[model samples]
Target: MEYIQTVLFQVPASRLEQASETGGLLAELDGHRAYLKQQPGFRDLRLTRSINNEGNVLIVVETRWADDESLVRYETAEPNVAGIIRKHEDLLVRDSLQVLDMEALRTEASFARLESAEAARSRLVLPLIVPLGVLAFALLAIYGLSRIYLELDKGSAVGLATGVAIGILLIAVYVANNPRMPAWQVGGIFVVVIAALAGGTIWALVQEDEGEATGEPTASASPGASPAGSPAAGGGELALTLGDNFFELAGQKSPTLSVAAGKEATVSLTNTGIAPHNMHVADAGGQYPEAFCNPGGATPCSDPNLIKAGGTATIKINLGAGTYDFRCDFHPLEMTGTLEVQ
Candidate 1:
């Protein structure tokens, strides 16, 4: 089903001197540019501006939906970006009064910017051979020691010593590899990751054998279904579904489109495309359609929760024929097309 995400991004209006544009302010706008969705659930979203306008600083969006169930799922489902929204919410002049609806596309850069493990590696442009080699070596040391300890079947002391050894080895490897970084900080993260992975493996080995003898497997109770969330059997609160992009309309930016002025329309945002994409609409009340003022997570377009990745959303509207900008937040510069509200 198609769903609509009617987002209202509210920015603040302050004096130019005190409210000068800075990293913090720009970051808030940037967050809006790429904030598609997160893991937990939808939290509050607020953007601040020191020098923006008053009433028009709001962004009104109408995300299309495929059906009622899809829309319901998105509103109640979890979102992963709550912390990011909170972290940057205070930096800008948060009017929470005005709304700014800006459309963001699931640009290649947008997904790349997410800093996923693969993305981080690609952006760094380093000789990965060395790092990979070091990682392999570290794994060997930890595993070898861990195996030895297990065979001996010693008490926690051996486990503790192995942990400490892994910690020191990780530090040595990091320092020898990237001395430029702070010795202490890098060492700490390196040791934690190595210890966790290695330690977890050892524990799992023991547990699996034990489970086999008991004749009761616990993998069925894995956290795969809900992601520690509620049941996915119900419709989506904020979910990613098929047919989100380029499905019915090949070469189209999004599968779902919004007809303006409150038309009872359904926009199914199926994410056929590999990258994530979100829709935004700005109401042009007989103007050039340049002003966008709105706040995120203030009220519901239909229900309040947001649409999820690869998920469909809906937007209902009845707009008179005029000009409106329906676009995505990812491709802010060129990923925009004209919407004539008939």
Candidate 2:
């Protein structure tokens, strides 16, 4: 294996610049190179200087040898690197020097092949990862914002969404203007914003679920009062409110509707939520045979069309005394109720 020796030292920036123009340091190193070339194991020599124009300039001198035995033979010689650098004590920074000896781990050709393979892999992966990461973040942002907005009134939702957008734009502008900002600070800002959005979305959903579970009405009920129980013995007309993913009857979620047997009953549906909804009652056998029920169908009863937010629709129920199932077509699993025909 090859043996390498490295000498590291620092000089005052001003002194290095002056020495370069006057060939002071360069001439001394050239004389030293001539001495090293006459040694038995000398293979190659390199000199490097830091590009940063800071207070001190760092310099590195590296020498390669054929093997450890040859390097050991040269180390015992008289005109060594330490003796050469000692002559320039006035130019170098105080105590800023180090010497290291190392054995080569890999040949130059193998190292080059490894570097080329790593670069190719990076090029292939970065292209796919960047676009996919951007797309996923965009989708998550949209979903989180939608969940938060769904809980607010129209005016509040618009105002909050606009403010959030403006805040994001301002942050983008700040990051663009301060390109030298620390990476950790930028990452912390992103993490805080995303966490805030996720927290708000979760809170909004929890509040909605709590409200639905408590059977709170989103809209005003009819003026006439019926005690909090099943509809009147012979249900003439009953009013129901459709909220987000739920149905409310007289401030009761998924309530049962009772009507006298062989009598006609009318149910008024008022949609107070953002999503469209329609009521569909199953047939006598408690089965919804049709994929899309028609209002004029012979079996189960259903609304002719979906009701938009703040819209209203009516369905007539007339059947033999029995129990039937009813649900909203748009949110069948979440918004369901029982119809009791006594």
lDDT of 1: 0.42
Going through the candidates in the order shown, the clash numbers are 91, 0
lDDT of 1 by residue, 1-342 (tens): 123345444444432323235655344445543443341233334333322345324433343344445445654544322333344455334644232223345544557666586767776756676688688967766775555343332235367677768977976896789768876786677577667666756764664455344322222222232232222222322222222332232234433332434443333333333333444555664232323212242111221122223223443334454566555443444445444444
Candidate 1: TM-score?
A: 0.27
Work out how many backbone clashes candidate 2 has: 0
Q: lDDT by residue for model 2 over 278-315, one digit each (tens)?
A: 78888888788765566777554446456655556778
**Runs in model 1 lying further than 4 Å from the true structure:** 1-188, 194-262, 285-309
lDDT of each: 0.42, 0.76
Candidate 2 lDDT at 185 equals: 89
